[model samples]
Target: MLTPTTASPRLKLATAPLMLLIGGFVSLQSLINGELASRLGTGLRASVAAAVSSFGSGLVLLTLFVLLHPGSRRQVATLGRRLREGTLPPWMVIGGLAGGLFVASQGITTPTLGVALFIVCVVAGQSVMALVVDHRGWGPSGQTAVSAPRLFGAVLAVAAAVLVGLQAGLDPAGAGLGLLLALLPLVAGAGTSVQQGLNGRVAAQVGPWATTWNNFVVGTTGLLVFWLVTFALPGQLTAPPRDWWLYTGGLFGIAFIALSTVMVRIHGVLVLGLWAVAGQVIAAVVIDLVVAPEQLGVLSFVAAGLTLVGVVGAMTLRARGVR
Candidate 1:
């Protein structure tokens, strides 16, 4: 639902800003997912529950879409055939995997780091890996040759992670573990770029909501399998969440997936990612101020500024279009 509702007149503005606004929802989703995890008692169970909720909501939306625009259904009717015949890249569904992991990570990390620092780490990870993903052709944006600007971007992101991680470790016994946990999003966040690319490709063929439906199926299934195998371990599966807000993570997820599909297509991943970075940072800062203002300080802003600098540096050359 990246598209604006008829009743909502404020968001009918130009495309770029709208996309950035949508990007900020990813931060909100992290906050909600974290809450859901805290209620559920473990990241693993929380992730599975959230994925199921996301998939359930997605299924309902897709059903409505199919009912309203029966024509689009015809377009995707060949989705199965095409997937089997190799007409579509099998990896387009990677968005689901990326999403599942992201929610899981958010659940695992957000409480400890708070929304602002947690999102900063996610952005830091995404900024660094996006370069490699672009260069290696793992991303939907196609091959982007490695360059000085991109390298500088990566360095800045790493430095920003360290800056943020230092604060994250301040009260903990194992600062090293804190540092590692802060940077874990670096690896997890890279999947998002890949997911955007693949999901964008799917949107090109089947349409935006349809693409999300596909992602829901894949991501939910992947997490379900993981949950079945791992939930038996200690400190894994616990009680179900009681709060209504916890369930809203799926709705937030649906919004962002659709936004990424559109924005990544319109603006290349560089601009889209960076623009969304601004949105997430702004939202994260606001959320922290309202809820846990004490967690963020000078170091948080410095890390965020460094991440922004990295994003700008990466855009110095080519952060857009096919190479």
Candidate 2:
């Protein structure tokens, strides 16, 4: 009863810009997460709690939207049938767990490392994992063999990540531990990337709205379950600050996830991932320069330049089909 979906040219064209926008949302999240972590200071646990709260709020809003919108109701029913028939892959479900972990890691690490450093670390993880996933063609979209150009791009991305890391002012003693924690989200991000690819394929078979809602439904459920078990202790899962700005961040987070899901359907993971990283780098630089001027040293600029060059270079190579 399930059929594959295909993106029209217009949709494909839209993916690039949309991915870039999603990257901006991600950058905002970095700033917001760092601020929250600094205030809470419970380390990784606090980040986990924040992730739970943010996602939990998004889930509630999405549920309300589904109830209010007559069209969404139909989409949900259709998706339910797909779920019943086992049309969606199990691995895609696992993507939800990865998403939750990524959020928690961001909340914990961003304050210590700063947005620039945190993003680079996660991007390093994402680039390498994305290469492996693409090369193996292991996910829902089938294998899109890694060409030579793609491999080169991955190398460049890694180099960029390294440059950014070196400039991040990380303590040598804590670097190992920090890097390990950072990888949790990176791994989770890669899973989500793959999940997006698979979901894209399934979305084409179903409808985009259905695919988006299904992911939200599944991912939200996963987040809530993990949240309840992990942070049910006293004083955990408390509300964020009373400021409207904090809640604004939550709204942006919801929009970011929703839009990125749509982007994955059009651009494929490679483009989506690359553009998202690029946007984050730009945003982090701006934030650093404005919010924490001391962090924007000469090395930061150099590293940022190197990262931009690498991203551009990789993109050029991809365009030319060198990989």
lDDT of 2 by residue, 85-117 (tens): 898545544445556666666677666556666
lDDT of 1: 0.71
**All candidates' lDDT scores?**
0.71, 0.65
Error of 2 at 290 (Å): 1.7
Which candidate number maximizes lDDT? 1
Clashing pairs in 2: 3-205, 5-204, 5-205, 137-143, 147-323, 148-323, 149-322, 149-323
After superposition, which runs of candidate 2 have C-alpha atoms over 4 Å from their true positions?
1-18, 163-173, 228-239, 261-269, 296-302, 321-323
Superposition TM-score, candidate 1 onto the true structure: 0.82
Candidate 1 local Cα displacement, residue 104, angstroms: 1.1
lDDT of 1 by residue, 18-40 (tens): 66687579888878877776776
Q: After superposition, how far is residue 271 of candidate 2 from its true place, in Å?
A: 3.7
Look at candidate 2 and tell me the lDDT of residue 215.
61
